[model samples]
Target chain A: MSVTGAGRPRLATKKRPGDTAREEILDASAELFTTRGYTNTSTRMIADAVGLRQASLYHHFSNKDDILDSLLSGTVDEPLAVGQGIQGVEESAVVKMYAMAWFDADQLSRSRWNLGALYLLPELRTDRFGSFRESRFTLMNLYATIAGGVVQELESDVSAGTEELPFRLVETIVNGRADTENGRGSAGLHHASLIATAAVRVLGFPGDIDGIHDRAVRVVADVTASSIFEKKAGHGQ
Target chain B: MSVTGAGRPRLATKKRPGDTAREEILDASAELFTTRGYTNTSTRMIADAVGLRQASLYHHFSNKDDILDSLLSGTVDEPLAVGQGIQGVEESAVVKMYAMAWFDADQLSRSRWNLGALYLLPELRTDRFGSFRESRFTLMNLYATIAGGVVQELESDVSAGTEELPFRLVETIVNGRADTENGRGSAGLHHASLIATAAVRVLGFPGDIDGIHDRAVRVVADVTASSIFEKKAGHGQ
Candidate 1:
């Protein structure tokens, strides 16, 4: 307990409404859960970090598992939504793949890659996360569609091999970089271009590489600008 | 405890020499450490898995940290040696990269991938693993050298970008596949070919992709055949 000058426990500000309370709890838990394993963190620690009385914390979340569910759900839904949006946009198949890769890497960077990395733990592998796994499978299939389309259009001899391999390659690049201590810091605007470029090359896209890089950068910039504007307008908030 | 027909604790065979005992302990610990995590697993559990009494286990190693050091050291040394051998081999830069990637993916697959995944755990990120980390760094630098040579010889406008990215990409594919329930069973000769193909492309190698893929397969097959012959001759055992 933090004590004020008079040695009394400092009062927390008046509690927020349930939605705000839930958001704050999730924001705090995501960081804690990423740095410390979910099992190692406790509800009490989360409550303390968020300045909520222990009993009050339950108003927003019933338990740690509930918070994890929310966190994992939020992390996947945005990129997958963005990916689905890209498919609706009229663009070349290669451009769409670059746009999705760029968007996904940007989203992962914003989430502090560690949050996405939580799935890697064996403890989190259970039937309860089956929905989460399904959502991810859907997202990868979306990527594979864009990649396979390009391969079919470009070369008849090559099959683009397997959908799973390309998807896994893109994932490997993202998560592998995330494992580095400085990975987050290094994932700036240009890094998204690097990721997109690498993604296409791994898919065996036989296109103009330089042109793809330029278009990917523009797509990422436009999306980021729009999202920033939305946040500023209090829509995302 | 495993129950026997007579319902008494089964008598373990008399203790082997220290070398054999250490190897058994490491073998048991690798599986337990990978599945249960190093921190969650106890020395007692490891000893039990290896058919050693808890006290007798201590005679071979001081504690869990020592056991972990041995396990990590063994895992890194084989691949590092193989990587170094590739560096010394007189081959084209692309061939060397493919050989290194093929050897690494094969070695990691043989070790069940969990052995490499242990480095991702926060608890293992300590000074004790400095030598292990250095050996890995050396191996990556060797890869970067080959990659740089390929990029320079092929494209004047292209930069090698970051050496770390390609290395991490390879690791991500290996570990990501490893996370699947039946990942080990899925890793066969064709998968190694797929990994090598993706690896060189990600490095921006402007060679004939088919030619590189064919050479990579031959290199991997030759190596695998030689290793099996050695094992049959009781050299590797």
Candidate 2:
């Protein structure tokens, strides 16, 4: 049975005892990994923290590294899917674009501090989850598509390629200076939200959807458009 | 006499034979503190890394925490001086503004990865050397002065307060989604460079600067102006 069974309390599953124990183990592991780094944390610590014997903990997971992988994937994988879903939608391109960033930021803030530390670990860097290159690329592509749709919607003749758009848009939003050191709340979140709102408005999106997604889309589009145009003009000089 | 002078190639003057050794210990400690976090690193490891006995290492710095403070102060204090120096400059406000950010980025990048890790440590959050809050606030004040100068140069009737101008300008530049995690390059360095350039241009200074800064300024100015106007218009809504 899955960790979260339908209509059942999360910890109170009717599945095999092993499955229930595994879920408990993962839950405890996630908290520890998030607070203490993966390397500093030990299997014995995890087992003790979860009120299980060290050997019992071993029975649920192979080792500390396995727990690390499971914890990270569980948090990020769903967010990635949500981002993908937004990309798939053909609604107002601006709406789709804002949704992707909002969801990503929300998910990242929820787990990024611990997960970000994991990325920095030497062991994880070489492991399967080390390279976030694929996830980044996918998200960037979605941003570019959304940006292009906005440009088209604005009725501008500018056909800036997708490759260029994501770099310009995402760079303005995700650069680390805007985020807290541990990747919690910081100027980055507020800036992206505002920029996204401005971008949609500038792209001729109706002001009806004044929610977070709409506001963020408008801000991002406006700032991005202005920045790109100015850059192009400066090159001419 | 000075810390750097302690590690000299020639004997210069007949100093204590162990003077060079003391300097070597500090130097090694600094490198370790930059790379390995304070809690993760131990005095014995640092001493061993420097090819010295732990007792010899203790003779230079009192403990691990003391070494961390020394490393952090050495790394960050000079940048703070540069920040102060630019603030004191009698040059055009735009020049002063640009120089502040330019120097900050240049110095911060000299040891960015280490400095970034230093900022991430929780203990440092309360410690003066560890907290970036003061330094960042000081820098913001400088940016605000520059932004105010730009308003005056433009002869715009809109009178923005010093506090508001910095927050607005920084918010516009650093707050975007592209500037956060999942964004490319270092956030602080990229934004600082971009803002330094933009502050100069937006202040209506003669635009002989490089293309990137020039473009960024123009774009940022336009967005800031539009956002302000929009906000005023929507104040009642």
Candidate 3:
């Protein structure tokens, strides 16, 4: 929320400056890209918004695509870094999961509207912006790794050989494509967090392994199964 | 997927020979609005796309906003109509839930890209468009009503009076949001469907209700409890 001098309105880089100009450019680009969209936004418009000449803007970025690539890459990398930092903390899996969710929620919510806008834009999916694919994979991997660690730490008897418990657990929480546009709300996030937390807890963490696995299994089964049953009843009647 | 008029370009309107030209203008406008965005898409560009004079186009729509308003209202209304059709059907709560989910999902996926685009546009959100607020409210109410009915049909002991159950269940399945750009995927959808089904089943249906309820409750308890335990264990470590 803090705007530094680096982000202040200055003349365009007809005369080359340092990384400060680059930072300012990106800051402005993220805002515009989120609100106006990439295809609709022009380099000149970006320069005008930042008090720079169109020609000068090119000195910093070869084209508008460069700015977009930079913006998406930078934004996605931050969360991954945060995840990595927490991994080194040596905290218990449950605490780690909470920490990760808290971090993701905090960061995502700050610019949730814009981030949502960016994702919805079809242009990002095209090959022109390959960052989309890479960033997505990176995020999935991060979640799986963290969730897997928690699973291993909690479940002593359950061998990790049969299934990728952490990946599924994280996927369960994070996946939201179902239920249409309504699916993307605060409620979904809460459900995912609850499910992930429960999964980790049931796998038997720092507590007594006895009964924990059964408890966790029963919880998942009941929640999933009951939902299915309810839907069938609605249909039958 | 079927185009009504394949090779032959249908007349934009049959109201007036002159109005046909206007219809073509609007048709072109809708396509651009979905792809290029509202603000970025100019009246001149729209007219050009339709092979018409800009002045002639204005004869139909007062301005670009008029074109956008028409497109958005139509999109919103179509879904509302589909949702309304469900109320007339007399079925069990479980069946209704599934049908509603299916309907919602189908509509969303069909207009997935456009909905995101239109929703993100700032001008569209402003008060220039009449009754958008009412439309949105109506949609939310429709979802709540459908979800509530499903929950009621599933629960046998209405004597207990669990009012919040409907809201919680509906919100969990319908309004759950994701951090990713696409906002959930196939896996998320499956999970939500499963959860909804399980919830209804546990509440119990008519035949062999007691047996089903007993089994459901045990399963839910075990799953919920186990996940919680896993979370605690991870934290402790």
Candidate 3, B55-132: lDDT as tens digits? 666666788877777666655564455455555445554554444444444344344334434555545444686475
Query: TM per model?
Result: 0.79, 0.57, 0.52
Model 2: lDDT of residue A183:
33
What's the lDDT for residue A35 in model 2? 58
Model 3, A159-237: lDDT tens per residue?
3321223333333222222112232332343333344333343334434323443443343334334544344322110
Model 2: DockQ score:
0.09
Global lDDT scores for all candidate models: 0.62, 0.48, 0.48
lDDT per residue, candidate 1, A106-221, as tens digits? 56655543576565666555666677767776776787787777676555243334445545544544354444552333332235656776777666675577887777667655
lDDT of 2 by residue, A25-82 (tens): 6766765654565546788887666566676666667778777676655544554555
* CAPRI-style grade of the A/B interface in model 3: incorrect
Model 1, residue A237: displacement in angstroms? 12
Q: In terms of TM-score, which candidate is strongest?
A: 1
Per-residue lDDT of model 2, residues B87-145, tens digit only: 55455555555565555444444432334444334455454443445654554555566
Model 1, TM vs. native: 0.79
Question: How accurate locally is residue A80 in candidate 2, as Cα lDDT from 0 to 100?
Answer: 52
* Deviating ranges (above 4 Å) for candidate 2: A1-27, A91-96, A110-114, A131-212, A215-237, B1-40, B90-98, B123-237
